[model samples]
Target: MEKISSENPSIEKTKFIKSKGLKDKPHNYCPGCGHGIVHRLVAEVVEELGIREKVIAVAPVGCAVFAYDYWNFDVTEAPHGRPPAVATGIKRILPENFVFTYQGDGDLAAIGAAELIHAANRSENITIIFVNNTVYGMTSGQMAPTTLLGQKTLTTPHGREVLRDGYPIKVCELISVLDGARYVARGSVTTPKNVLTTKSYIKKAFLNQIENKGFSIVEILSMCPAGLDMEPLETMEWVDKELIKYFPLGVVKDV
Candidate 1:
């Protein structure tokens, strides 16, 4: 067997290319957190589209608040639940540049819901990367807007109640109904196939903006092992076996 080592001749022949849109450094995400994966996907898509230089990203006030540190391109911060509104202004002002926002479920479906809806209603030419982990990961696993029914969190000790907490918000479904929302989709990172599918969804969202189609969003169901108090593998299994039943997967709209 060929040993994989730096001293090995074969190892020297191999090339490890990092995404041009991503900085070469360690991220602060927890082990098994899907933020890192989604970040790479966004970076790869931006680089592959050859728009890294012209891309502008809005960072959400969630676990990924430090997203600017990892992304090599220009990134600006937005107030909690305000990325969509901020992105709208940036895209309108710099119509020639590619703009996008990276937001968590809490930032998007909860506090930012109004901004997102209005942005989509106006058909803002921007892409949105919505990561739904079903909990407020940075806030000690509190119940988020997208938290599944009956799901337990720090705030919901005995699982969520439908009458009390209401049903989980389905952002893609809600946004797809808007006439200005040209594209909306839901994807997951629970498996290799799903990961690739999610990347394709993100790429499509970006392309839609380039074509001036309208507002585009890709809601990614991601795993948060630490927030869920489960092992990485177990959290992944939960997403596949339980969470997906409510969220499902695939394009909700494209027109």
Candidate 2:
């Protein structure tokens, strides 16, 4: 530690700092957004596994579409809801590479649902990092396929109606049932402890591929205060009190 004069000698210094897997650049995410935290978690895993240079991330349209700008690694952009299909081709051509898809609810659970389901059912040797923020964050706070039953959005101004809007899709639960998926889990980034656990889940998902286990995916519950029109703390509370009740976080399935 750099010891200074007696004026500041009482303050203790931090001994261990977490790995910064991202580049030194300003992120485009909102102040309270949880994507940034998950991004670091993913990066940390890549660095720890010594696969930074071998990673090929497929990013589709969403708030995190500019993810390539933040991660100091190889990343390819796909059309809306086409990351899984694109990732499949890349992984097949370069089987030695660590290929993964980073998708939001709108990109993964909505239009890309077919691609995601088919990919998992085929037991593709790739990792999927899914971020479920509950709404179409990039398209001006619109209602997405994963929006909660009573959640309000630009389309559902007076709370989502189950009859008219239908129920939110449980992505992990749905994908876990597939025979090809060996590892499927849902985690949250609402707190520090949760963040650490989520990172562990991500690591396991990636390792499953290295070990030739099968397809794996980790869906993360993240906050989007910008789209929710709530303060950061308020958003955190909503995630704990409401969202968790619907999409309970845990290891949905593991083989």
Q: Please, what is the whole-model Cα lDDT of each candidate in the order they appear?
A: 0.92, 0.91
What digit string (tens of lDDT, one per residue) describes model 2 on residues 122-165?
99998999999888888778999999988889999999998898
* Worst 10 contiguous positions by lDDT, candidate 1: 1-10
- With a 3 Å backbone cut-off (N, CA, C), the pairs that clash in candidate 2 are none
Worst 10 residues of 2 by lDDT: 5-14
Model 1 C-alpha lDDT per residue in residues 107-199, reported as the tens digit of each score: 999999999999999999999999999999998799998888888899999999998999999899999889999999999998988999999
Model 1: lDDT to the true structure:
0.92
lDDT over C-alpha atoms for residue 250 of model 1:
98
Error of 2 at 172 (Å): 0.5
lDDT, candidate 2, at 150:
80
